[model samples]
Target: MTGMVTQARPPRRDDGSSVQIGALVPLTRPGWIEAGHHLLAGLELAASDVNDAGGIGGRPLELVVRDTAADPQKAAAAVDELARLGVAALAGEYHSVVARAAATRADALGLPFLCSSSVLDALTDQPTDWVARLSPPQSRGWRIYADFLLGAGHSRIAVAAQPSVYWAAGTRILRDYVAPRGGTVIELDMSALTPAAVCDELAAHRATALLLLVGHPEPAVPIVTAVRRDQRLAETMIGAPAGQPEFAEWAALLGDDGAAVPFLRYLPERLTPLGEQVETALRERLAAAPSFVAYEGYDTVTVLADVLRSHGTDRARIAASWPSVAVEGTRGRIQFSRTPDISVWQWAGPPVQVVDRDPAEAEPGRFRVLHTG
Candidate 1:
């Protein structure tokens, strides 16, 4: 969590004998640091496991990590530097916008990038074999979330959204998906309103559900507190489709207030044999339950290691091998193909679940599976 570079073991041969995969992660402020920590934990853990299982053709798989700090320009620059450093492939990014920038640069450089946790539908403006993704796209996940909202009898929905490409795309996805089903999405620009003003708007609009299309711990935590304490909106549901409640920081900040806020998670009803083992290792590594992002990190390495073994460390071969990947990941059998509207070779079926912290359970990480898609 603290180091920029992480290696599974000392080099078996000379320092230059190992295969290096460039990792792009956000490890500082303004980024989701907690999510970044878990992501790095999974990536490093899998790298260690790959070494343990006789690394790619007996060469140690090393990770040369660079912190993006959630900045797209910074991430693009990191991709350029990593390419110059001779990394055969690139991996690991949480923010969708940052991943988009990194993916574009990686494609231009002809370096294969296996994106770990960015869910934006358009990872690139045009499809290319250079980029592939583990996480489901925003349109698929957010549309499932909208269906969960409509199924729960929440017809009138309000979104307190900040201005960003990711937030705007989520808002548009919810609006387009929900409008046809008699559900209305009312947008409240968070830049122009305080937490108290958001509550007032919710009450004025008579919204039954309020979605936080904003960042964590600032407006999101305060807005949840305001809406929870307000007597007028006691029955209103608070939702974060971006998976804010999956992290311990949200529960630590909001406590029971954070419970019951349904969010999107890409996990199955039960972990596969590989998944269960990785979960235990990740919990020990992270000192808490691993979020879905952690599993994404593990699977990204899992796929990349297999590719490196099969195709050597050549960048062109790695990019060409994405469609033929058939590794069994922690969650399920992982495979990549062209998904409709998604510009990357995507894992078409990473399990999507709408889960919330169960207030009934007095524990922090206890989540109730409300609905699955």
Candidate 2:
């Protein structure tokens, strides 16, 4: 909801043939308007860049956006309409529930569904052939995160997540990743508990580290707030992949240093070469669009243009090319698998930085990423 997506901008091709690309994700979330606009900006940027360089086989690329409001049923209907309209291909669906629905329908219709967001690992192995994605499976994200933390000498970890279809699935992936490695499973799924309760459990459970898995739009505020206030919790921790800036913002509301403290972020690590540059530029160029999900939408269109350009007017060919359609985007380096109808981007680690710090700084000793608890 926090991500901005753009509508169909005016075409820039001399041939006047703007290849239509369908979007099946939600466009009506709180920050979505601006996120959508940013997405559109990124898409338009991709299109203009492509056309200026080569014009996608001499035909400019275009985007066809439709809102699904994060609902699977509505997402499917949107995909159906887009398919009927005969767009060259589709992009930008974030949720796994919606992604599966759209991917299934696309498989049935032989249309290309280039999923942009959704970290649910299950979406990676879904039984569909129409999905050519640029976002990696959610489960794949955990392994990198797990390894990253473990590599950094963080083995005694704890986990938390909100209570939604998205976070529930994320909880499973995180639990699986942390448990097998002999790490503590303090509050594996925090969806059922209050943030204060989670801190109590973490303190009582004696967890040495923290890992949060968030996916729902804005449910993390209270949870992070409680964690920051509760003396039972440790300061040094990491967060899940879904909510980036939002997580930091929420934590900041709890206290000044709540957001800025170092946490091992999963998504930033996977940023592509250009994504890293764009992320840097985006931070300076535009206000941080509320949710990190916005970038998924931004990357989806960038890759869609690549596939449509390679195979002219052929959906199946474009779908098949998912595996070969390689590009560097804001989310990361994207490459979809042909055999499984899944796209997994490479992961890269970004230095942990804080956002939404309190208006004033605390004394140097007040807050730090040390384990005083």
Candidate 3:
């Protein structure tokens, strides 16, 4: 929990009328994309649920969505547009990149913002009430990961990856564990020009294990393929959980992994109790569904609806309710940090590290809980 502090804020009217809530985030990403949809679904359900149970101050709720493509620039633009529209607050962005952008965007415009999936621990690094993050932050998640690695006997580990915010953000987690205990760091480029160069680089580090943090579609294949083709590959290869989705495909293409690599994901079960329940509900609702982006879109709506229904149409009132609010969506507990703009500090909040999967059987639907650490 971040320290309580007062800050500048805006006032809202009490006309007992409906108001619009904005969600600026990427509607198109694998795995977590459905989170947005589930958010919306939960909100839509909450809207009806609330009205039936008696709406917030006797007024209905509405949610507006703006796609960010998980791109920071686009996210900022979306925020500007939403602010012009005069929505109550920012709610339900599942991606870290979009979440970070949401913070900056909300702060700049003095709009209240709430994050549904901004797990990047650096997001809450300052003092600002305009933005609050509902998802558990990443600090505890990193600590849990460090303990998991140490327990796994992965001492001589190497960190490798494509250049991405997710990858870049993850390096700090890896380094926290490695550098402190005298481990190796091998930065591999994901450029199309140097395929073999990537493999040789990791091998040169002479690490017993490697952790690859990759971006979309195929950036990780080259590094994995190179490692496999080379006989001198590290005995143990690991990767961030988000990068786990594509590894199975890449692993099959390379053939005969000899189990050299294990794509480790922070499992969903480890999220807050509510986060776990939300993940389960989502899987059950969209069992074997291809269009996961729908979930992301809907989830955003759900969280927004909850905030609007419970806190009236005031941005400050809604944001203030974040820390105590609950949304029964796909990822579970939606509690956020108070004055979340400075969420990066240890005082903010610690994100839950649900080990999505380990090396052996971490495929898309075949996730299993490793440890809650």
Tell me the whole-model lDDT of each prediction, alpha carbons only.
0.93, 0.57, 0.55
Off by over 4 Å in 1: 1-3, 14-16, 361-364
Instruction: Find the number of clashing residue pairs for candidate 2.
Output: 17
Q: In model 2, where do residues sit more than 4 Å from their true spots?
A: 1-17, 30-40, 51-58, 124-126, 151-156, 188-191, 214-218, 234-238, 246-257, 260-285, 288-299, 326-335, 338-373
- The better candidate by lDDT, 1 or 2, is 1
**Model 1 root mean square deviation, Cα atoms:** 1.3
What TM-score against the true fold does each predicted structure earn?
A: 0.98, 0.73, 0.72
Compose the digit string of candidate 3's lDDT tens values, residues 1-373: 0111111111233764456667554446542444445444444443444455444555555556676666777778878888888888876666786678778878778787766555676664466656665444555555566566666676666665666676677777667766777654556555543656766665666666666666544555556566767777646454454534422344345444424343333234434554444445445654533122333334455666676766667776765665665565444444444433345211133224434322455553344445564
Per-residue lDDT for 220 in model 2? 54
lDDT of 1 at 166: 98
Q: Considering every candidate listed, which one attains the maximal lDDT?
A: 1
lDDT score of residue 285 within candidate 2: 42
The local lDDT score (0 to 100) that residue 315 gets in candidate 1 is 92
Candidate 1 structure quality by residue, lDDT tens digits, 78-190: 99988999999999999999999999999898999999999999999998999999999999999999999999999999999999999999999999998888889999999
Rank order (by lDDT, best first):
1, 2, 3
Q: Kindly list the per-residue Cα lDDT of model 2 for residues 1-373, writing each as its tens digit.
A: 3222343434366557667777664557532344444444455455555665656676666666676666777777777888898887877765567777777777777777766655454553446556655555555555555655665576666667655666666556656876787654555565567666777777776766666655433445555666666665645454544534343344434445345433323245346676665565455445653245446655766777766666676887876675576677665466654323233322222123222222335542232322100
Candidate with the larger TM-score of 1 and 3: 1
